[model samples]
Target chain A: MNDKKTTHFGFQEVPVEEKAERVAEVFHSVAAKYDVMNDLMSGGIHRLWKRFTIEASGVRAGHKVLDIAGGTGDLSYQFAKLVGSNGQVVLADINASMLGVGRDRLTDRGIAGNINFAQCDAQFLPFPDNTFDCITIAFGLRNVTDKDMALRSMLRVLKPGGRLLVLEFSKPQSEILSKIYDTYSFKVLPFMGKLVTNDAESYRYLAESIRMHPDQQTLKEMMDTAGFVRTEFHNMTGGIVALHKGIKP
Target chain B: MALFMTSTLTIAALASAEKMLNAALRYDPATRIGLAQLEGKILAVQITAPALQFFIMPMDDELRLMGNWDGDVDTRITGSLLALAQLSQTEIHNLKDSGVTVMGDLSLLADLQRLVKNLDIDWEEMLSQFTGDIVGHQTAQMIRAKFGWAKDRAQSAQRLTSEFLTEELKALPSKPELEDFYRQVDDLRLAVDRAAARVETIINRKNIKEKSNP
Candidate 1:
């Protein structure tokens, strides 16, 4: 490991070792309210974002699926039904609180006999190579310390011809819309966080982290660099969110 | 031993039902219109309580019972046998809240529901195929007369009840009475509006005098 390695904890520069702990703190602080906050903040369009991801996933029965950083298991629950009894879906998240909430939610919905839970960082997936037919990380990649390493790890685990779908907040396509989105994110989002979860700082960090993340083209190039072929992205809701898909050759 | 017996019985019952329905669909062109939409699809019917599995395969102008599949199901319809009975004769729109549950692709489920509702069997035409034309025609005429009489009786009974309620018992108001009631309410509203206008005019005049004096 490089002794002087540094990464971003939202807008703040921190040691690579410290970024994961800081991100854990943010997620742990907002874990209970994560789902509700997503609804309130995105006006329930986050469901559509995740739905589009599932549709584009082309997942089928008897296929093995991995949902990394799958907080609350929104994608996993649907994938469980799509994959049915013969298939397996693993919901992996680094934060224990998020993983607990996800496990409980899936159990309560009676989505079992097919789903498994794992608590592990995205950069080091605990599975055999070429094991999964599909892997998805929804709205969770931006928070990782080394996104390049995470992409490489995902590529390493995906089977030949298997696909990876990354659903994330991206730079809005138009300037006027971007300004409006920025205003809403910086002003209304924090205010909502304070009102709902009483954690404005965490939400502020969320906004900053989204801004600090790479743009759509940059991310596709990064995936390409990580050995994912034919990488493409679909921008949704005026590019406030994007679903990037790539296939392993 | 019990499980094997039950499975055997289910398969037998499904085969019989499929034979009966397919025979009916063979003679009834109206029912085929909706079932045609479900061609090349397997609709799994799961009857609860005893928990029986049956499959309906719509293929080339016919619906056949392809028995119990343990593999991936395309569309599944689950309910009690009683619910299935109700589904055959009743429109799905009518059975929306009637204790029957359907889960599958929306379009496929809709086609199946439509097929169930539109399955109007013409027994006369079916009987003509087996029996001679004269006997079939006479039998059909007799049946139609009976049905027509029943329908006329029902309509007459409904009309008698309505006439009794309106003319004899006076349970509902006459048209004249209803019209008078509406006119009185409209007059009362107009009177209130006039009174409010007079009050506003007086207030405005007083305000104008007060402003001029000041």
Candidate 2:
């Protein structure tokens, strides 16, 4: 008889303690080709989604921002520019491979001085209380082993009145779109992954994990339960992805 | 969400616009340098006819356009699309009658206007990136000559049409003729006023004589 706590790793249930390690392995495998795969898989819609998130962030000069799970420094690069010389942006990721890729990409792009790279988990941020004015996790919250704990940690590090934005895949609103999306995700995505990165299993896990992640309304409730205020969500691409925003009050 | 479609479409449009603008600016290094000076300043453009608002912020040598912005703006211009377009090319003093309203940081608007007026794109250099330098230069020269000839021909045609109408056909008055007509009308108006004053004096004198006889 097994007595250990269990959590969902893709479609399979595993010991809660092992979920992070499994997720890390998946990211490490795909870190180098992550950006390319994202562009190809999403048909470059990911860039538009990320652009929308940046516009919604309300980040300006002289504001500290924390971009958790900021793989390849997409949001962090923009935030560093927005914050200017006086502001700071911390790009934090749990996977060392992803963090290393992000740091190298950002440095190569000549984005430095205001940006910092951190190998830290969202569940236990290493920052002091009330530090960041805004925090964002783009397509990353779904992979978190304990999302509620991560939300709490984010809230703890955010200043009063600061907002957190969560951009992730969610349930589609239309039935037809959902069916088409499922077929594409299960059939086309992994094949492309195999062709490009030679890692079909990781892409399959991505599809399964997206299916297991909470819906838009449920995630809003989770943020509310984590002591956030004024939680709301905006669905993009016909609800294939949603961005949830909550203010720390 | 309705808000989702609006924001998504807006962000996408702004992204494309920014890309095209930066691409054009790449050939105009002077304009790019001028843009760098205005970095971090936000400009809000409110169009009354379409009822749309967007914010423009310059960063480095690029421009970032946003559908929504929360921070304070350095300048805000509210007008119809045509009025705003005219304001960009027209003089600042003419804006009062151009139906454009401007608020905050007048100097910023002046600086932007100056920059826009001074923008000179180097099409030869841009084309050289694709074609060889000699071919690019020859193509650019041909284009310039064609444009100059077309402009000269258009101006000459306009002048000929004006002369044909006013001098030959006599269908419209020339500038000097119109001024002379205006001067004659003014003299006639003064003459009429003088005659009316003389009649009023005679009437007053006749009324006094009648009162004395009574």
Candidate 3:
């Protein structure tokens, strides 16, 4: 925690202020090809990972939900339904391009009345404190410049007894699987990116960022530090993807 | 059980849960969604869109092919994420066989469009044709490199034609030399890049407009 302000854009060290714009550029460049690349590189496993995340979210009717870094609204869409007509799901993200992708996806399903889209940075969510019943950041936290700051903001915005679910890539459970995933991610992923999205660099950054994110235990501790109670992690698929859930006590 | 509204299953809620679970088995499921299956049901991830091409694919044989997942052939396969709800091995299989076709709702279209452009070259080509290129690659590359895209990462790119190239070529000097036109062609390529960027911007904004539609 240096006040001088340093951050990482993928693997490179830099001043924190410029990171958001750079992140935006990568997303904007790849917005259209994002989903196709996900299928090509992950062999559609990302879908299962996301499914696990949704299954863990516990949202229900009349519950106000906040989907931070809700890229393409994978989780927000789920929250919208569980919350039903009386509840509202706000899909927010720093990158307009990513938010645009999510917004369009939700609208096409005949679900416009229950959802809203807002462009916001996670470090400083636009909503007032204690407003949401639940908040989720699915695969969105790794792209943030300040993970701790974003987590704190998330904690601050939750109503008492509200839950926060962090669904993201985590360290693999097995060394053998890690090695295989490493080789596959570092090698085949970039090549697939080149062929599909024509943006090998973005794909490379994604792989790198996954390696850099906090592991399940560390993330759980961070949640605890954010004043959450009953913080626990659910390891999915050998821990490649983990769901960290905590209640706002 | 957890004092978090964990109540015994009712028939009506169970039915609603079944409907939602049926949807999830067909599409993407909501993350951390406990309400979906109080009775072992699951809610599908919702995707809303004007296009629906990306989300709402018909769950036919063609549907399974969209993933192109080459999972093991010998093993009995069920629930590959891309599998239609009817085929899942979960107890919710009965719900899946009911044929609900709405895909999950998407949040930010720009993100999906970005993914689509990266994964679907056809989509990218369509965008590039709609938008003319103008921003110089060298300049754009320089910007990204400054922000730390690896030398290897910065180099990977899609080759797209510029609408400005031909237009600019026509505007060349009356007695322009071959070298001048060659440089102009280079400039045209840059223009095409800009055009592609614009098309993406338009698509993202258009999608947002669609999201707000009734």
Candidate 4:
């Protein structure tokens, strides 16, 4: 009965084709203030989140890594050091503005000779098959129009025994904690966003999008369906954010 | 309502303090570089009483907090919150003697102690960002002089207090008493060694007779 392909964009249903454009606009508007807004909203716990991701990543020297939708290059910067001179890290993002900001920031931090940049969509990574030893999407997977396609794309580029780590906002595990989180995300978050970036709607979208994202179990199942073996998820900050990891066969 | 308000205010202040400390530790050149010895090492500090655990990773001039590191740490330092506070103030010397329990590598404890002793904050470098070089340098020099005078006074006071306790009040063993105790222990050890040698000589003579008879 329902033949039309529609996807939810922050609680609103829209054609799958148009979702990417809408997401692009939101990122383009907030790209400049993304890092600052993250520190403000999360109170710098995002750094700890990324640090945990790195620890679980098992990334070592001389490994090729791909960071999909790597906005502002925080993960990429750490990965560059981890991979060392013998290794390579490609920071890929769909939004040019976000990618440009990431490139400039990383360059300013002297992260060169090992790190590369790419403005590519997650649904269709432009790397060769079996290209990377590890692939990471930190807080970037929720914005993708087709998460399944992106997962498969990541899988395609990953070598056998390679790992895929998906770090994103997820449903809270407790009812009481969920209530507090809802209050903070809806009431306090948008106001803070307005104060910093002067765009309440963008922050509102962030909150809504996080709610709409797949919960931990569902995401683990989805990763399994995408032909990734041994999928697991780690709930952090009372399930406010989850880091899901899967391995390629 | 007042209780709830107080708790909320406390949480906000703690959060602010954590953020500020994170930035300060990251930006301070000496602390950052000094922490490099902790590279690839996960150090966990467990504060009893309040029951808090902080996992620390020291990278190249950066102190990274690995969130809720429940894994095995290279070193774990546990103490009462008061003891840890005393340690930060250098009020407690010798953590093991101060009732602080240390598990895992002892080198980590030594490294941390050395780091605490050598912690020198460059206030002028921090001030130069706001007030430029010359004024910052002058202000820093003045502050350093005052700090030096205070440090001298404190050291002298500590020496006097120690002397009063050990010599005047006889609260602790005096130097001669301690030396005499060490001398008695050494003599006892030598006497034990001589007795052991006599026993060994008897055993060797009996063994020789048994071998000759066989």
Recovered fraction of real interface contacts per model? 0.00, 0.58, 0.00, 0.03
Candidate 2 stretches greater than 4 Å from native? B1-5, B117-214
Model 4: residues >4 Å from true position, as ranges? A1-4, A39-48, A51-64, A82-87, A128-134, A159-162, A174-204, B1-38, B42-55, B68-105, B120-214
Fnat of candidate 1 is: 0.00
Worst 10 residues of 4 chain A by lDDT: A47-56
* Candidate No. with top TM-score: 2
* Candidate 3 wrongly placed segments (more than 4 Å): A1-4, B1-214
CA shift at B76, candidate 4, in angstroms?
Answer: 5.2
Chain B in candidate 3 has what TM-score?
0.18
Q: Compare candidates 2 and 3 on DockQ and give the better one.
A: 2
Residue runs of model 1 more than 4 Å from their true location after superposition? A1-3, B1-214
Worst 10 residues of 1 chain B by lDDT: B1-10
lDDT by residue (A1-249, candidate 2, tens digit) is 879999999999999999999999899999999999999989998988888888778898899999999999999999999999999999999999999999999999999899998999899999999999999999999899999999999999999999999999999999999999999999999999999899999999999999999999999999999999989999888899999999999
RMSD vs true structure, all candidates: 23.9, 18.2, 27.7, 17.5
Model 3: lDDT equals 0.63
Locate the minimum summed-lDDT window of 10 residues in model 2 chain B. B1-10
Against the true structure, what is model 2's DockQ?
A: 0.31
TM-score of each: 0.58, 0.78, 0.56, 0.63
Per-residue CA lDDT of model 1 for A47-121, tens digit only, reads 667756765676767899999999999999978976768899999999999999999999999999999999999
Which candidate leads the pack in DockQ?
2
Candidate 3 residue A90 C-alpha distance from true site, Å: 0.4
Output DockQ, candidate 3.
Answer: 0.01
Residue B163, candidate 3: C-alpha displacement in angstroms: 86
lDDT tens digits by residue: candidate 3, A1-249: 567777888788878888888888888888888888877776776665665455456565688999888888777876776677889999998888888888888898766788989999999988899999889888888889888888889989999988898888899999999999999889998898888888889888889889989999999999888789999887766778887889999
